[model samples]
Target: MNIVRKLALSASMVALCCTAASAANLTVGFSQIGSESGWRAAETSVTKQEAEKRGVTLKFADAQQKQENQIKALRGFIAQGVDAILVAPVVATGWEEVLKEAKEAKIPVVLLDRGVDAPQDLYLTSVASDQVKEGRVAGEWLAKTVGSKDCRVVELQGTVGSTPAINRKKGFEEAIASSKNISIVRSQTGDFTRSKGKEVMEGFLKAENGGKNICAMYAHNDDMAVGAIQAIKDAGLKPGTDILVVSIDAVPDIFAAMMKGEANATVELTPNMAGPAFDALDAYLKSGKQPAKFIITESKLYTPADDPKGEYERRKGLGY
Candidate 1:
């Protein structure tokens, strides 16, 4: 090879080696909340992909939707002395002690997709969407769609204490406060699972005069929405037509439902929360630059008019 070509090749090889070495030098621990829903599963898949793309050595732990399990996992990561820790908290409380341990260990903890009730100084930064805004979007759409019509809505809430559940419910309530016609007649927690969603929705359908009294169903996530759709069908009621369906988390299945005209609206909660989490970690580790206490993600509303078929195609391979 010519001398110039040899130099270029050597430089390329050096850059590649340096990149690999950099990634190898840092180890990150990810404590996921288990595959509680399609959205959560998609987040896990996307997180692993992001870590792989960055060449990061990712240590994973599935907490199975238990706060105690998550705490134990965090302790395990701390004992392992991983470079950093990423957590999708199952609940908002009871994290301060473990986080304090992480703080003492000097391992920066980054909360992904959810937040804890602990003090801000306990972690590095949180990367999540404005969950309340997501609810507001859903509520606003419902309000506008059924303007001046008395609408008795039923809500499928997420896990009781999780930040998304709390914030999303609060936001939806706030949005519909001005609309006297819209009221949440019955609300129940689905624990953010499809099976539980279906079970609770069945009860709601039975309670609300065989689902005739209900004007709409709003879920905290798409998985629950899909479950509710099945329940509505079992009651011999058309989902999107008989009872308007709106929810958060634009999972691919929800798009499929929308395509089938079984669901009405959904708000997008991007599952790639790890992308920004990694970005903040890289910046903080390299330059001691602190990312904002909260790294807010973007959310958008989706409906049948937005082309559900295309959306389903786009997200189907993302493990949703």
Candidate 2:
């Protein structure tokens, strides 16, 4: 071959390889709903790890419990032209416009741990635990324990507009509706934070008659439940005995509380949603296939009698 022809061929091959590499280096932008709970932090950790393992470039944005921040981050990701986007929405509403924009850009969006109210076709898939079932599990456990005993419950809800808070509350209420003995006397948002939970629980403790009318406490997450335990202690009440406590999210602290008999029951919301979300992303991106509208994860209920010490030890090692 002539030297000039050889040089031209080599240059053409180099350009083609560069183009292929650029196409293969999928850039996925992820907007997390801040590290509010142990479960949320663990989800973030696993997501980053998963992206690294798959050799995909990840651009992360922490919304810090603000909806405006998430909107801004979504816009930034759109401007940057990410191949795909993953959002753990801070709340369920006010996502229509941003999602529409992403869809117009032809970037697939995957929801993690929460579902959006937008049209399902706008987002590629949602990978989340069934909040309704989780709430029902807690309610069933409580009902079985209480039986026909009269129960006045104080509810510590999650963030107001969040899916977990809304769906969990609905499911729990539905499950306990037929049981006349189980009634929610007081309910308020704890914002899914420990401090908020403690503060709200304190108010509940100070309610008329020294919270004597309250028989149990229910929190949306384990952090809040643990906080409620502290409040119960400060109020000079026996947590597990005098006032039963139940919550969702089987975090390490909840396990510890269970071991100490300070908490009664919890429903596990595993933080491993990121791994399956990424798998869905990989499949869709590689094959041009559309994934399911929702991928529901299975969860379980935990109690003190369910190997309390082992549960505590195992959760402690989970880097919660």
For TM-score, the strongest prediction is 1
Q: What lDDT tens digits, residue by residue, belong to model 1 across residues 1-320?
A: 23235334534544564565664456788889989567778898899889878877677778788887788778877886878999999888899999999999999999997778999999999998998999999999999999999999999999999778998999999999999999999999998778889999999999999999999999998888889899999999999999999999898899999999999999999999999999999999989999999999888999999999999998998877
* Per-model TM values vs. the true structure: 0.76, 0.73
Among all windows of 10 consecutive residues in model 1, the one with the lowest summed lDDT is: 1-10
> How would you encode candidate 2's per-residue C-alpha lDDT over 81-143 as one tens digit per residue?
878899999888999999999999998899998877888888999998999999999888888
**Every candidate's CA RMSD:** 8.3, 8.5
Residue 275 miss distance in model 1 (angstroms): 1.3
Residue 67, candidate 1: alpha-carbon lDDT: 80
Runs off by more than 4 Å, candidate 1: 1-26, 63-82, 90-106, 117-119, 158-166, 188-213, 318-320
Candidate 2: give the clashing pairs: none
TM-score result, candidate 1? 0.76
Scored by Cα lDDT, where does model 1 land? 0.89
lDDT for each of the candidates? 0.89, 0.84
